[model samples]
Every structure is written in structure tokens, then in C-alpha cells.
Target chain A: GAGVSQSPSNKVTEKGKDVELRCDPISGHTALYWYRQSLGQGLEFLIYFQGNSAPDKSGLPSDRFSAERTGGSVSTLTIQRTQQEDSAVYLCASSRPGSNEKLFFGSGTQLSVL
Target chain B: SQQGEEDPQALSIQEGENATMNCSYKTSINNLQWYRQNSGRGLVHLILIRSNEREKHSGRLRVTLDTSKKSSSLLITASRAADTASYFCATDVRRDKIIFGKGTRLHILP
Candidate 1:
């Protein structure tokens, strides 16, 4: 893909349901990141992936949120027992190693928990 | 919080005027970056300034960093109506991850 791609641009789920959001980073990019943004709020870091390993998961809000990356390319963010507070736009970004921190972003998935 | 936070949650300006947005962070960083988002979509990288570099320029965008103060600013010269978007500041505090601020909404009126 020419740019970062994310699936299911919009999702509506009921409370207690589990949801999975997928991210396909730009080809050959070695770094991938997930962020969450609520209405009228700043982006909150959720996770970071370098290859298949996540060096930092400290940002994950709670046990209900988890993510994984495979093949150094696609990544998935899963939220368990979704709550209304979990509703937000999830953004994904990718960057090359030593690219001066330049990141390419995807359109993002708007998750709405009812 | 490694993510930088921008000031002035919103700003409205007339086209052709210069608009400036400021960001401040809490920790040391390797570099600071600016991004633009339109209508709550994906963000577009605008400019980046390394900790050592005081300033950088990209077309009409000028970014300045004050590492000693842990702050950075983005200046858009001669803003256009098309420039209306939300501006974000992110800090490259850790390797492979950048922390992003809430963002400043910019409205450039024609």
C-alpha cells in the first residue's frame, strides 16, 4: 500500500462486546504505533511496536486493551468488554528506523461503544 | 507525560495572516515534530526539529525548538483558507514512538 491502511473505518459496538481494530502500516516501515483520541481531547498513546516486540506497553489504559504486531507489518488492537468510555478514534502510524521521527498515519477507526 | 501539549485550544484567523501555535513538553526529547489533521482524519507530518537544531523550515512552515525550555512552536506563514485544520505537536521522547498533544484547532478564514 502507498500509505498506512486501517480497516472498518467506523465501528459501533455494545457494552461488554469485544472489538478488534486492525492497522496495516506502510511497507518496509520498521516502527508502528497506536494512539487513542477522544472528542475534544489530546491523543493518548496506547502501544508501540518494533517488529513483533512491544518495548513499551506502559501506555495501555487498562487490562481490557491489548495489541500485537506480526511480520513487522500489520498490527491489531483489541479491546475486551468494551465500555462507553472506550469510544474513541484509534490512530495508527508507521515510521522508518532513523527517519528523524517522520510518521505516516492511517485514516483511523472510529470506535463507538454504546 | 512525554507528549507535548499545545496551548490556545482554538484560534480563528483571516487568510494571509501568520498563525503560530506553541507546544510544551515535560521531558527530554531527541526531536519534536508538527502534524496537521483535517476533519478528525489521519495526521500529516509537517516539520521536525532535532533537539540540537534550533529551527527548521519546510515551504511556508517554520518550526523552532527551544530544548532548554522543552518547548517548540509551529509558524504557518501567509495562511490560506485551505490551511484550516487542527495542528498537533508530538515529542520523540522514546525510540520508535512519538507522544502527541491534544492539538490546536486552526481556522483560517478567507
Candidate 2:
């Protein structure tokens, strides 16, 4: 892909339901990141993947939130027993190597838990 | 949590005027970057300034970084209606992780 891609641009699910969001990063990019943004709020880092190494899961909000990057290309974010406060736009970005490298972002998945 | 804070949460300006936004961070950083986002859209990288560099220019955008003060500023000259969007500043600390600010909303009026 020419840029980062996310699936299901908008999602509305009932509270306590599980939701899965997908992301496809650009080819050959070694770094990928997941973030959540509340309305009019700053981005909250969720996780990071560098190649196939151990993912940086330090930012995952809680045990209900988990993510995985398969084959270093596509990634998925899963939220179990979602809460109303969990509603937000989940963003994915990819970069070349270093943290300072420019990040290409996807349009994001707006998950709404009603 | 966010690593940086941006001031003037919102700014409304007429086209052709300059728009400036400031960002301040706590810890030392390797580099700082500026990004723009339209409504419900992904962020677009605008400019980046390395710790070793003080200032950089790209088209109508100018970015300045002061590592000593742990602050940075982005200046958009001759802004246009198309420039109406949310501006964000991200910091890369030691190449570990990238942290973003709350962002400044700029509304360029025609």
C-alpha cells in the first residue's frame, strides 16, 4: 500500500461487545504504532511494533485492550468487553526505522460503544 | 500520556495571515515534528527539526526548535483556507517512542 490503511472507518457497537480494528502499514516499513484519540483530546499511545521483535505494549490502556502485528505487515487491535469510555478513533502509523522518522498515518477507525 | 503541550488551543485567522503555534515538552528529545489533520482524517507530516538543528523551512512552513528550553514553534506563513485544520507537535525522545501534544486548532477564514 502507498500509505497506512485502517479498516471499518466507523464502528458502532454496544457496550460489553468486542470489537476488532485492523491496520495495514506501508510496505518495507519496520515501525508501526497504535494510538487512541478521544474527542478533542490528544493521542494516547497504545503499542508499537518494530519488525518482528517483541511489541511495545506498555501503552495498552488495560487488560481488555490487546494488539498484534502479523508477518510485520498487518496489525489488529482487539478490545474485549468494551466500555462507553472506550469509544474513540484508533489510529495506526508506520515509519521507516527511527522514532524521529516521519510517520504515515491511516484514516483511523472511529469505534463508538453505545 | 502526552509528552508535549501546545498553547492557544484554538486560533481563528483570515486567509493570508500567519498562524503560529507553540509546543513545550518536559524531557530532552532527539527531534520534534509537526503534523496537520483535517476533520476526522489522518495526520499529515508537515516538518521536522532535529535536536542539532535550530530552524527549518518547507514551502510556507517554518519550524524552530530550542532544545535548551524544551520548546518548539511552528509558523505557517500566508495561511489559506485549506490550512484550516488541527496542528500537532510530536517529540522523539532518544529514538524510543514518539509522544504527541494536545494540538492547536487553526481555522483559516476566507
Candidate 3:
């Protein structure tokens, strides 16, 4: 793809339901990131993947939030037993090898937990 | 937790005027980057400044970073209506992950 892509632009789920969000990063990019943004809030780092190595999941908010990157390209973020506080826009980004490389972001999935 | 915070949560200005947004971060960083978002969608990278460097310019955008003060600023010269968007500052602190600020909403009135 020309840029990072996220599926199911919008999702509405009830409390205690489990939801999964997907992301497809740009071809050949070695770095991928997931971020969460609530209404009128800053982007919160969730996870990061560099190639197929172990992911950096330091930012995952709780045990209910988990993610995986398959084949070093597409990624999935799963939230278990969703809570109203879990409602937010989940963003995905990809970048080249270097640390200062520019990041290409996806449109993001807006999850609303009722 | 957020690594940076942008001042002036919202600003409105005439189209031809310059728009400036400031960001301050905690802890050290390898590089600082500026991004723009329109209509609450994805973000677009604008400019980046390395920790070793003080300033960088791209077209009408100028970015400056001060490591000692742990702060950065984005300046858009002769802004246009198209430049109306929320500007964010992200810091690459070490190799962990990029931390973003709450962002400053810019409204350029035509």
C-alpha cells in the first residue's frame, strides 16, 4: 500500500465485548507503531514492532490490551472485555529503519464502547 | 504518560499571519518531530530536528529544538487557510517509542 492502512474505520461495541483492530503498514517499512487517542487527548503509545523481532509492548495500558504483527507487515490490536474508558481512535504508523525517519500514519479505527 | 505538552491549546489567526506553536517535553530525546492533522484524521509528518542540531527548515515551516530546555517550537510563515490544522510534537526518547503532545489546534481565518 502507498500508506499505512487500518480496517473497520469505526466500531461500536458493548461493554465486556471483545474487539479486534487491524493495521496494514507500508511495504518494506521496518518499523511499525500503534497509538491510542481519546477525545481531546494526546496520542498514547501502545506498542511497537521492528521487523519480526520481539515487540515493545511497554505502553499497553492493561492486560486487556494485546497486539501482534504477523509476517512483519499486517498487525492486529485486540481488546478484551472492552470498557467505556477503552473508547478511542486507534492509530497505526510505519517508518523506515532509522530512528528519525518520517512516520506514515493510517486513518485509524474509532472504537466506541457502550 | 505523555512526554510532551503543547501550549495554547487553540489559536485563531488571519491567513497571512504567521503561526507559532510551542512544545515542551520531559526527559532526553534523540530527535523531535512535528506533525499536522486535519479534521481529526491521520497525521502528516512536517519536519524533524535531531538532538544535535538546533534548527531545520522545509518550505514555509521552521522547527527549532533546545535539548537543554527540553522544548521545541514549530513556526509556519505566511500561513494559508489550507494550513489550518492541529499541530503535534513528538519526541523520540531513546529507542523505546515516540511520545506525542496533546497538540495545538490552529485555525487560519481567510
Docking band of candidate 3: medium
DockQ of 3: 0.70
Sort all candidates by TM-score, best to worst: 1, 2, 3
What residue pairs clash in candidate 1, if any at all?
Answer: A42-B102
Provide per-model DockQ scores: 0.70, 0.69, 0.70
Give interface RMSD for all predictions.
1.6, 1.5, 1.4
lDDT by residue (B1-110, candidate 1, tens digit) is 43688987899999999999999998888888899999898999998888899989999999999988888889999999999999999987767768999899999987
Which is superior by DockQ, 2 or 3? 3
Q: Hey, what RMSD does candidate 3 come out at?
A: 1.2
After superposition, which runs of candidate 3 have C-alpha atoms over 4 Å from their true positions?
Answer: none
TM-score of chain A considered alone, across all candidate predictions: 0.97, 0.94, 0.95
What value does the lDDT take at residue A52 in candidate 1?
A: 89
lDDT of 3 by residue, B1-110 (tens): 88999988999999999999999999888888999998787999998898999999999999999899999999999999999989999988668478899999999998
Considering just the first chain, candidate 1 attains a TM-score of 0.97
Candidate 3, A72-114: lDDT as tens digits: 8898999999999999999999888765458899999999999
Preferred candidate (lDDT higher): 1 or 2: 1
- For candidate 1, write residues A14-66 as lDDT tens digits: 99999999999999998899999888677888889988899999999999999
